[model samples]
Target: MSTAAIDVRGLRKSFKDVAVLGGVDLRVESGSVFALLGSNGAGKTTLVRILSTLLRADAGTATVAGRDVDRDASGVRAAISLTGQFAAVDGRLSGRENLVLIARLRHLRSPGAVADELLERFSLTEAGSRRADTYSGGMRRRLDIAMSLIGDPRVVFLDEPTTGLDPEARQEVWRAITRLAADGTTVLLTTQYLEEAEHLADRIAILHEGRILVEGTLADLRSLLPPAHTEYVVRQPSLEEVFLALTQKDTAS
Candidate 1:
């Protein structure tokens, strides 16, 4: 098996003459979190789609989970899972049902057991029977991710997983993502949130103009930019500070 969970070189794609990914290269280590940071239309989604086998690159080679993305597409598909921007849960079905449905589709022997296991793992056992429509944004996102893991894929692609989520909900999802890497699942995440990348990624690549502008740890990337200057200000004391000083003086007296 390849040491890298994902490997790409000279990747290129275009849509009717408008180039999306132009000679991009990336490497994601096994069991690590790699964040691709880009603004909307910067080709992050396009790159992910290509890696996940949903789309093919016009040029370049990609190997995902040790299988060539083009030559061994099926192998790539079998070893990876993807969750897109929006939660892909069925609103009418309960959380448990949604997982069971995915398990069945994946040809698991006992779909019900698989569903229960995932619910417990995601901390959704208490709400497993509730309709997905009733789930909070965080819960639904959790369920969506759980469904993606039905096959226990080696690599998981999360494209803007926290989009539209509240701050608390986003934090909840972040914890779940962190747990995935700790459990030895290689996560390739695409997001526009700079803080999200900094918080979750072991390494990050900034994609701009269909190319990688920089790739490294947070500190490494920061070092490439001009140094920041800090300004110290001295200001008049507040009323609280003045009162504290008078109280101390009286106590000493």
Candidate 2:
């Protein structure tokens, strides 16, 4: 049986009169990529913050890596890493420096070795010596994620890691995320891109109006849509479909 890496029950959070997470409930299996799909102001970030112990929940309970977020905030924080929507690399530092700084902060025995290993793993070795300000969006985001792995936390929370990147850059980050899951790191990703969830997540949850409308595997979600009927006619693609198909080709090529 798969273990539950993150478990939430009746989670409620609000900012004054505004309810962000309205009695939400969720479960994420260990060593799997779980994507939370939502629109702007849908409380995705708020839920992530609560799970990461960065914010308090108004009610309900959340446990991450077997640690209760409210009662054992320190334990929960120690077992997970969070990457917000924006890359948080220091522009003044080199990519190598950024990783080394984080490893040292985590009190790793050999920060240099840790940095070097991550630099190679993220394909940033060639750019490791250059200042972070000189890196492309993808490189910076990769470095940000590398820094988050210094302590090999059990779970990772990524809040729209590809938000402002071009298609190519987004694809680059997607590969890195795949590697994380392959290495048995449980990941909770929040993304507005349906294609992203379809491509990367083992299970997906759609959040709306501060609650989960549905949660299941891609096949399960697809089953919710009406079954297609067989047709012998060729159909023209919709404008959105054309745009997506073209963009996918552009990224792949």
Candidate 3:
């Protein structure tokens, strides 16, 4: 059995005349949170969809949780769960009901027990009986994530989990994601929020122009560019100066 949560090499994809992904390679260790950072339309979603078996790559090999994405799609789907940019719950259904439905879909025999556990775990116990449409944004997001955990997925793909959330709500979701990874679940997170990646990722991979511009730990990546530091003269030190120095920016700091 392979311990790697995900492995991809020479991954290439194209949408008609445009190349979306060009020779991408990634290797995520078991139980680690790997953040793939990129701007809009940078193929981050495409990569996540392909790994979660929602989209197929035009070329190259990929595997997830020891199952080949191309040859063993079922196995990959069985081992992975996807929480998209938007909540996928049925708004007409109650929180607990949504979880039960997904549990059933994943063929869980003890769907009731699973639903209760997740409801409590995600702090949705009070709202579990409420219709998803009536729930707040945070509550709905929690339900969406809880639904994905119905079958104890080994790997999860989170694409912009906090896209439409306020600061507090985003922090709540971040904590939930941390808890998931701490419990030995491998997470492939793609987000435009650099601070979010810095907070949660064990390693970061930046994608630009359909290729990985860089990949490394936060500290390591910072070191790669330069060793410039800033000593703020003002009593209230600004990170802007430090950032500019580190990034080798000549914007007159």
Candidate 4:
């Protein structure tokens, strides 16, 4: 079996005359977090959709979990899960109910048991009986991610998972994503948040103009830019630093 959880080469896609993905190449190692960063319409979503088998590529070869994306799509689907930008849980259903419903749909032998276990894992046990509509944005996102794990997939694709979330809520989801990687699940994250990539990804790729502008460890990428000069003194921390500090304090308390 191939050691990579996802492998793609010469990937191309188009919508009519405009090319979306132009000969892209990527590799995601097993049990690590790989973040794809791009601005709006940079083909991040198209790349993710193709890799997850939701959309087919125009040309080139790709594989997920050792299964060819085109020729063995069923195997690819079986080994991976996708969580979109918005939460997909049913607001009318209780948190536990939503999970059980997905488990049952997946034909698990004990849907209720699976739901209960996931609730505990996600720290949702206390709110499991509450309607999903009543949960906070963070809680709802956690529940959505829990649903994706019902099949115990080897690879999980998170497409802009923290979009529209408050800083605290975003941090909550970040912790959950970090936990997923710690448990040996390969994570493919597509996002506009550069800080998120720095926080969670083992490797990062910047997609621009239908191609990867750069790919490497965070430190490696930093090296490409001109070195910073230590000639100035700051009177106060930057807004991002203050925000992070405040959030960390809130979380600690």
lDDT of 2 by residue, 1-253 (tens): 9889999999998898999888999999999999999999999999999999989999999899999998999999899999999999999999999999999899999999999999999999999999999999999999999999989999999999999999999999999999999999999999999999999999999999899999999999999999988889888889999999999999999
> What is the Å distance of residue 104 in model 4 from its true position?
0.6
Clashing pairs in 4: none
The CA lDDT at 212 in model 3 is 93
Query: Would you list the C-alpha lDDT of every candidate in the order shown?
Result: 0.95, 0.96, 0.91, 0.95
Q: What is the lDDT of residue 18 in candidate 4?
A: 97
- Window of ten residues with lowest summed lDDT in model 2: 228-237
Model 3 misplaced stretches (Cα beyond 4 Å): 233-253
| Model 4 segments more than 4 A misplaced | 234-253
Candidate 4 local lDDT, 50-84, one digit each (tens):
98889999999999999999999999999999999
User: Model 3 over residues 26-131: C-alpha lDDT tens digits?
Assistant: 8899999999999999999999989988889999999999899999999999899999999998999999999999889878898988999999989899988989
Summed over model 1, clashes come to 0
lDDT of each residue in 41-67, candidate 1, tens digit only: 999999999999999899999999999
